[model samples]
Target: MAGPGVSRRRMLGWMAAAGAAGVTGASVVGTRLATAVPAAEVVTRQEIRTLTPDQRTRFFNAVKTLHDNNAANNQYNRFVLTHYNFRSQGHGVAAFLPWHRKFLRLFEAALQRIDPTVVLPYWDWTLDSQRPERSEVLSSAYFGGNGTGSNRCVTNGAFAGWQVRYPNLHCLQRQYSGGSTIGSWYSPGMIENVLNTNRQSYDQFRRAIEGSPHASVHVNIGGDMSQMYSPNDPLDWVNHAFVDLLWAEWQARNPNLANTYNGGGAASSNILAPFGVTVASTLDTRALGYTYPRWSGSSRPA
Candidate 1:
């Protein structure tokens, strides 16, 4: 449930009361309370298309390594299970953005463990809204094309033969909504409308983005991407990186409302579940050690 009606004043009041109670942790509201990261330490997440040849090779190799590590605590399967088990807490709620922000951070950290130089790259589907199948991000050279055969198993690209462990052992799969092609996605104009229209409230903005472009991408991609275990698909990471970037862009545009969080019967101090940190802590991307590239004058990133 989402509380789009929660006002800015009420949200601020909740933060004030939390501070007065002497709440001291990453969950505390207010940007000033967030632990500051050194500028040199902060890394920028770039668009998937911008990654160089070597960068692409390293990233794909690192991800494949994680997938191949099938030990007792396999890091890759752990993420997919986490998302599958706690799917409800992260979606259709005000904490959607914050929950996924931390989710992406943890996933990125796992990748870094394999290759220190690798960072998560976002897939700006807006660039391929009209013909998603043609996007380089989904080419055989990258994430791979649509699933083939009756099982729809992906047989090309970085994760072509990946057989996910959670639930059951099955080859990674994808089914485009439009036969061989995925139908149109949310355009830049559509995302800009979401950003412009929901400036005053956190829940409003969260719902706008989540219900529109966010859901569209998942539904349009189909197959594992449309399921709770969607993280099984590597594209889930880059897709969410872009979603998280949109939330960051919204936060940047509303400096005064940076800490404004409420709705879905959630308090700012409420934990994001699984991730020990509170929702408040996940609000600041820089504090988490990464941010998207600078935004151009247009809604798309530079």
Candidate 2:
């Protein structure tokens, strides 16, 4: 890893050189670094369930603080609007993964600004694929359960009765696809298969993951989550964090294909709007100052 103050371009150049020189070793993202980047600077995003009680409290508190701001120009609403405005360019395209990767980093930064100790936690829906409604994530103790009444306003959890402004003023809501229960999600085995099948192609991998498992979570969750302004629901952050983790895992598994971005004529130089960062720059998660917990075999880190 490169030392502090190393530019992303310089680090990427070093990585390219290391690859060309056939350098290899055990490292956080499965790719050995040719230079030193501080380990402490790279925070590991843990699974939501793995977070301690205090950590959960801090995370939720920071999120609620942003929610409470509720100003038209608030950072939280800025994120929701950004996602809504860029929906066409960000979704169903080769840039989907990279776009969300950058977006999540920005959202996480906002939360961290309020509480530096908080790192975005991911919801590993694979763990709840069997009975999503019964998952602890939806319990009142965490994100709260389904919305009640005709309006479908969220009446529980950290964001209950939260009002949002995008297209109009409305309360945050959720209507599970299966009435009172959310339908089953993709299994760990299915994700493992996705990782294996699209090992060499970024486009194929993006398509497979985005079209199926990724979309399933949003669709099943329904209401605000399914709309263009999905970011209105705080679950969007954790859910996308999980999606980004899967992409990172795929990249780590295929070290030689680290910068293998393609499809839709999307070059590594193409800029991800709103951030002004190139696709190539977002390729390495560690270079962007974060990584998911290291894991082995077919299972994700708990």
Best by lDDT: 2
Instruction: Kindly list the per-residue Cα lDDT of model 2 for residues 69-167, writing each as its tens digit.
Output: 667666677777667666666886788899888888777777877887998999988888878999899988889888889989898877778988765
Clash tally, candidates in order: 0, 5
Could you tell me how far off, in angstroms, the CA of residue 197 lies in candidate 2 after the best superposition? 1.2
Cα lDDT of model 2 overall?
0.75
lDDT against the true structure, each candidate: 0.73, 0.75
What lDDT is reached at residue 163 by model 1? Answer: 81
Tell me the tens digit of each residue's lDDT in model 1 across 1-302. 21122233432332223123322222212111112233348898999888898998999998888777654246677677666655666876677788888888877777777788998899888888787889888888999988999988999998887887655667788988778877676677767777888987888898787764766676567777766668889999999998988888888988988888885544566887777678887878888888887553254544
- RMSD per model, one decimal: 9.5, 13.3
- Runs of candidate 1 exceeding 4 Å displacement: 1-40, 70-73, 264-268, 296-302
Give candidate 2 regions above 4 Å deviation: 1-40, 263-267, 295-302
List TM-score per model, in order. Answer: 0.83, 0.84
